[model samples]
Target: MARGRRLMARDGVRPSYDPAGPDQALRAALQDLRTGRWMAMRALLADTTQWWRWTQRTQILAAAAAGTDVVRAWLAEEPGNVHAAVMHARVLVERALRARRERHRRTHELWIEAWDAAQSATATAPRDPVPWVCLLALAQLDPEQRWEEHRAAAPEPMLPPGPWGLLAEAGRRDPDNREAHHRMLQFLYVRGGSGRLAEAAGYAQWAAGQAPPGAAAHLLPLYVRVERYRRDSGHDAALDLHWVGDEAAREARRGLHSWFENTQRAERSLSDLNHLAHALWGSLQFSDASRVFEAIGPYFTPPPWMYRTPDRERAVEIFVQARDRCRAAADG
Candidate 1:
């Protein structure tokens, strides 16, 4: 068993597979998961779709159970695999902080390095909006350096439209493909700074406008960020609480919390958690932010020694302790 594989041994919940093979099954793969059957999934890994779904499960199930290292190796085989990068990073960040809280500095460093690799993975797929969005989320990480780099880009020709440009244009075409709308939001966000940031907000509002009654699920989060920004800028976060409005807001809050609580899908989990914590910190939820911030610090916090380690788990914990102490001192 690997270092992290020991996580799943608890309660003897073994991974199981269905009565489906790679080709012969229509939807047999979706069969319910039964415990004490880790051998079932072995053949399934040879396929792609099955692999993808398995990826999700392996991450969530394995990580929550504590088989984080197993998840890491699984993700490693698929380098440049965005999903893997995201999932693995989430675990590294979380476990790192947990380690740090326990004062296991050496182990924490191991995880932070993993988190950075995942963060930089987004840059590998520069053409993809997802990666750029990842970078944007990290803008505050090295604001002076990153902003300077973005600013220093050579003025390349306004070349023929790329996918990102097309997505931007599509928003104007129908002004309604929720996806295109988000694509535009991503573009403006990656562009960074106040002007582009506001433009992203505009696109988000446009998305809200186009979302049908079914759009509330997606719209609420957009609105929350918009609301948060508005509040920060002294604008109003509409306190209106209609039945739909209240429900949407409530669900959005829960969804975000659930995202943070998740152990797998490392990159996304870490990213979302970091964003939530920062948002919480900004909102003065010091204690809540402190816990979350500690949970994934080495990856998210701005520090050199933090970025130096391979055991991201250990690095994160150190970050947590330092941050909490700093916060404590500030409060004191």
Candidate 2:
């Protein structure tokens, strides 16, 4: 077992939170962005055709580019280029979000700039859903839903009013967009209250129920589950039952059958896979969990695992123990 652990470490079997995950092209693109080159980014975005992949790639690229002027340079070099224009919006939005996180004095000003850029991106790429998704992302900064469009009515009575108009616009361009729904859920989280969590859970169920098989929207409930756990005061004592409960098991199995089984190996979201793997492991579904662990390979998103324990090292220990147990079960 010690030998196996050493081999695993040497083979890079430990979990990582690399944004690029297994996407070598995206990793290279990020490297290029850091070096003040935009060509690689342009090529990467150009090749991303699927709406879900486009949202994921743009988000990762935007975060990487927000710290630099590469995206602005891209816009300057290719004035009127729709892709560059959209990417410029992405970078602006990311910067605005970072500013908000840091409580920068210019948060409001930056938010307006992001909103304008995102609104412009919609014109630049009328058929693309990403710009609308960007708008949805920014909606979190406005907890009151001050903008009339931001306070649009929910589709169902139980759900609260939110930035549903922005969500609808994204859906219009690309129905059941995964990131868009997740962004909405984040907005619900920002409006923190006991009731808001209930709203988020309801919204997750609604989104998951409406999505087609294999849609990333199926992962929504698992995210809400984690959010609930994170907010629970007595989580330590209730942790085991919280995960292995009937509802948790149902959510895990539903996501496995609907999302994992239906998604192609290359197209799966690393974060989604991590959440599914965590959910299944927590629910004591080791046999099914092992398949997800194998699918995850060396990548890790720390949030799901980190929630298991307050001690960061202990969290990693839990992750390793679960992974090894799953692997051992599979070996039989």
Candidate 3:
């Protein structure tokens, strides 16, 4: 709407990589963790009741706390604390993944340590899905599928065997766990080749189908579409067609209905919101995209947008253009 545009312009709504969006408590907790303090992280995790929020906050905090001894200190101060134990696994997994990215010689050792921590956390915090998600995170680092559990048979013949057992454990603890599905997709990507796209797409559809109303799982298809686009070497015209295709539109609509419409704004994943907005805008569902853009506010994840352009500034420009056009269309 023109009103929406004016409000956005007046407020200068810009994209940011703010780890804590609309959650001041998380922001403060992250700050404290960065300063090597664990109390705020401790309190925040204690107060976070929602599984999705718990999973998200722990992963974010783990990333920030990985370089410090905050998690270790917390564990030492409160032995057998489930939150600290799970977070220790998360930080170790984060370190392992980072080591893998950097081609560090210690990657395998870190991965094994992370796996052990996560496995221990599962016993300590059986009802919490974060530990299972932590194990799923490690699944990608083992591309050879060396672990028997990682080579579990796929539910459908079309899909490849992967860490389905880890995913199932996460789902058992928290159905439609967002990070768990994404971790599986990361493994599929590591599998490499055109076949990876099919695996990812099939996996996305399977997950989306089982998703309940208000679950972030509905956005999986949109992410797969982006992955496909990223893999394709097509020109602008072909890429445009890919985005506005029947299937793309259908996925966007399903996400809007099954997830966006049913979930509260504060509860939505910032990454999921960005993907939904990107898909809706790409599919020419401007009105629907406008709503998603509004929900996104200033919180923007690099992903799905960065897939458009490798240049950070260009990606931001593209994001802003799509958002403005959607707002204008809704207004008209």
Candidate 4:
């Protein structure tokens, strides 16, 4: 039997549900924005120092909204608004990514606009990591414009040499910036080939190892597994717990358990929890998976879940089915 199936057959793992408070706050903020309460969203973004957390939530929200009028208005009112500029750039990048899926020819143009906006934001707020994170994301989307080529082309460069350098700069600004590392992992993944995947896994392992205990970076390996599965077998392949080697699997499980021990559910990102829940389900730790499912509630991030099935409705169905099965096993 597969490792997950074997694990599922054994019982005794208890389930615990603790909703991440910060995630809840983010959700609330998003809801407020959706309802036209600009003050709440403005206050959320006004904290330039809290860029890491706000940026992550903002990008997720921007992707979901698919419109940037409010954010654009904020930028228009305060042209020097670093937060607004970064978010606008993120929204453009998000749209560009979506367009790429439809084979839109203007995807590159959107990316360029995002890059320019990100550059402006970085220049305006040299100390903030959010703009750098945005730039790193743009670099990933448009690999041709990474540090090396940009350096060779520009007489004077404001940003660092490449995506690696951009990531390093973002880390320097905020050492434990979850979004920066996530973007780096993504950049590595898109730069395809087995060697890059291995490197990505190594990076994930290293990041997880270096992160403070209970941080969301612990799920990096799980993200790598999803990417690897997609690359190797395409989207429709069976979800394999053994996508990584045995040793890597052990490390991921160890990291997941560590995260579970240290994490406060209400403070964790939905994406992080979703990734953990998916990983647990894949590993056949149904009880543990059930706990994460409860914490996640109804919110679903595209990433690891959507990778299983590109169709949104289908992805939700798969998630609900897996979640139900895991809950049933835990209850039994």
Clashing pairs in 2: none
lDDT of 4 at 91: 74
Error of 1 at 249 (Å): 13
List the candidates' TM-scores in order: 0.31, 0.94, 0.94, 0.76
Which runs of model 4 end up more than 4 angstroms from their true locations?
1-37, 47-52, 64-66, 99-101, 144-162, 192-195, 234-245, 306-312
| Backbone clashes counted, model 3 | 0
Best by lDDT: 3
Per-residue lDDT of candidate 4, residues 1-332 (tens digit): 45335333324222222222345565676777676555566676665245556666677667645564666666778777666677777777777777766878998888788778777877877887877887777656654444462223211233123366677778888887888888877666655322367767777877787788777778788888777777755544454745435754565476567776687654577777778888777777788789887777666666666667657556655776778788899899
Each prediction's whole-model lDDT (CA):
0.39, 0.87, 0.88, 0.67
Candidate 2 per-residue C-alpha lDDT over 1-332 given as tens digits, one digit per residue, 9 for 90 to 100: 88448436633665657999988999999999989999999998889898878888999999988999999988998998898988989989898889988999999999999999999999989999999999999988888777887778888998888899899999998888888999999899876322488888999999999999989899899999998887773536666777889999999999999999998988898889989999998898998999998888888778788877777666655777788787777788
Clashes of each: 25, 0, 0, 9
- In model 4, what is the error at residue 15, expressed in angstroms? 18
Lowest lDDT 10-mer window, candidate 3? 2-11
lDDT of 1 by residue, 1-332 (tens): 65234322322322222222122231232231233232223233334343224333433333342333544554656665555555455455446545644768565374446447545654553333332332332332222333342233321232211233334333333333333333334334444332344445454444454444422223324333633343343233432221135444443444345444443433233333444444444344456556654455334432221332445555444434435543674566
Error in Å for residue 202 of model 3: 0.5
Model 2: runs farther than 4 Å from truth?
A: 1-12, 192-195, 233-236
The residue-level lDDT of candidate 1 at 314 comes to: 58
